[model samples]
Target: MDAVPGRKAPMASGSAPDLMYCQPCAEDGNKILPDAFCPVCKEFLCSTCARVHRNQKITKSHALQDKTSMPSSFCAESEDEKFSVTCQHHSKEFIKYYCPRHDALLCGDCVIENENHRSCMVEKILQVAKRYQEGEEYISLKTGLGQMVRDIENYILYIQVRMKSVDEENLTNINEFRKFRNEINQYLDKRENELLAEIDQTKRTSKTFLNELKTKYTNIKSATEKLQSDLHAHEANSNQLLIVGKRAIKELEDLQTALEKVSMSKDVSRYTFDRDPATERLLASETAIGRLKEGESTTTLGQQQQKQEKKQQEQRKQQESKQQQHKPTQAPSHKVNFQSSVDLSQSQFSRQPDIPMKTSGDTRNCFLSSVACLSGNRILLADYNNQSVKLILRPTWCCPRLLCQVDHGTCVNCPVTGQPSL
Candidate 1:
């Protein structure tokens, strides 16, 4: 029999059948002509078979189309048609109900056998599947999936931008480093050339000194040889021998004096190259030459502090000398003993009672800018209005005698040394 166009015929050589045989009836060795096709089961069905299929609870929901209107592709048997939808646990039963608790579609036998679904509600799988189609849960799932996709896309973009920034930063750093390195190299090259020139100058100077000595020696040797030859010739002529001998002896004495003056002396000609002490130390230790040393900064700070202290001391002495000129009788010198009794371990300081001091013979309003307590009841006070520092001696409680007044500038207190500076 000739095969229908776009449809597969059975694997049998025979005369043409009046109608297409039902696949399910063929399996039972029955050649029943099919009137309809079950799309879900992918089977051709006779009227009687279709009625039986519709009567079954499991297959009732399956869609059936008239065989005459069915597509040629549906009539053809494909690889998908070879598979049957049957329960893995119960091969004879079709999956019908959905167990919500187990989240699985199960046959009636499987639903009964699964102990977890014994007390749980089981709904028709077709009804549950219908609920999933465009339902609230389905819409929410789609929205969530879309949000996740958008979030992932944004994250990817963020990562890309971050990576690009990192790359650019890394490139910038690399360029900056290269530029710095180039500058350093250029500086080093210039310094190297300068040093080389200095070394060359030293070499030329030494060579010149040596060459001068060589020329002097050469002249001396030539003079001595001529003198020796003249002496030998003069010996043969006794008459002129005495005169030539005297001149030769005089020349020899002069040569000896010149040689004594030319004797090697460091004070006359010394050629030694001295490296900077810092550079020498770096080389000796095999350390990087350009790196800053901790001691250098510390020493610089120490020197500045010393200078500051020295300046303060000089100011203090000038003030003291000026105060001494006004006093008729010399004030007895007193040493101030600054001793603290506070325990360091306790981290506590002892507070002393505040004593107010007043001076006598000051009727005018005086704005005191600075005050310092000296030894033996003496206090130095700087009056800003008067622009003068007064050395007042408090002999008795409030009765003060003005010892001296000196022209003053801004006054500073030397707390560490307990000195008054102006």
Candidate 2:
């Protein structure tokens, strides 16, 4: 009788032949039950298959829940299943009671039984709870706004810091260039000093060689002239012939042979003085000196390496320059035109202004103000200083401009009851 109206026979627990079975182990897949279920489909699985699924690192969060049943959507600390209660005074909880003074929670039983909250006004407690809820929302918005403000402030500071750093870096680069120029100048000075010293040494060597050659030439010329004069005197002597009778004739022959030998000696001395070997060496040295004056023009290893390094640095700098240009775009400009909406029965607008100013040749500044839309489609200008509120436009106009001027002695939240009052 407990069966489905006795219409059919109940299947045995272990006799369902059509149930899915594990292909590898040949066990009932649904009821034989794996150690855990798949996180993706929540399907039961054996330990061996679980190991296989665990290898997928990204799918690791899909692990089975501890108890195997689905988890609840309700708050973890709440036991209530109905009336979706939340802490009105604590700003947090979906079904929990909190005491604002003690900053704690109480279950439903505790609220009825606990004596700690006996004298507390329940309505006031509820009001505090409501305020807490509103405060929570307000704090959330404030947090978001604060984060945005901080981000914008940090962005502005980053831009300034980066711009200053760039300026300082450029100044440093200029100084480095000046230092490089000084270094080049000093190198040239040292090079010139060494070259001048080499040239001076070469000049002294050339001058000494030339002077020695000149002195040898002068001596040779003087010796040749004296030898010629003595030979001429011997040829013209008359007493010399008187002494040369039969016995003097042989003496005269010997004297003539001795004078020929002396003339040969003078010729050899002249040849030795005229053909100075040191003079030829000095000429070769002068040729080497001229070659030294014209320095070798071939590139050294250091210069070639420096050129290559500069090319690579330029490529890297170009990539960095491209990255620097990748930034978010500016906001779109909205122009208010009043003539387009002539048929609409009701017109609504909030006054807000975003102004842009060119900071420099390559930069700009933008300032933005808040906007609020109130009742009556009438624009209200909220001036933080002047206690007066100005009606910006008539109801006939669709989009009107709102202007607010601040005076020293005025409150922004002054009543909006009569004329000149917001």
Q: Which candidate is the best by lDDT?
A: 1
**lDDT measured at residue 143 in model 1 versus the true structure, 0 to 100:** 95
lDDT per residue, candidate 2, 1-422, as tens digits? 11111012435788643332222233332334344454444344457656665775544556654335533211111134432656454334343455655555654445566687655433323324535644666689889999999878877776787679769977977787778768867976997798778767767776776676566656555655655555555666656534434444454566566556545542212111243586468556855212213334434445657988999999999888667645443342243322321212233334535322223332322222333334566555443333334434334323222212222222221122211222
Question: Which candidate ranks first by TM-score, i.e. highest?
Answer: 1
Candidate 1 lDDT over 1-422, as tens digits, reads 12332233644667554346776677567887678887766667879988998998767887888867764344454423432578889988777788878888788898888888889889865447745764687899999999999978877776687679769967977787778778978987998999889878878888888888878878878988999999999897887998999999999999878776766533325567676897667568854434323442323334667988999999999888767644564233343223311112423333434334334655555777776666677878877765667876644422111122222322222233323322
- Residue 319's lDDT within candidate 1 is 89
Q: Candidate 1's error at 142, in angstroms?
A: 2.3
TM-score computed on alpha carbons, candidate 2: 0.26
Residue 360 error, candidate 1, Å: 28
Q: What is the lDDT for 388 in model 2?
A: 35
Model 1 residue pairs with clashes: none
RMSD in angstroms between candidate 2 and the native structure over all alpha carbons = 30.2
For candidate 1, the TM-score is 0.41
Error of 1 at 126 (Å): 2.5
Q: After superposing candidate 2, which stretches have Cα over 4 Å from the reference? A: 1-142, 238-422
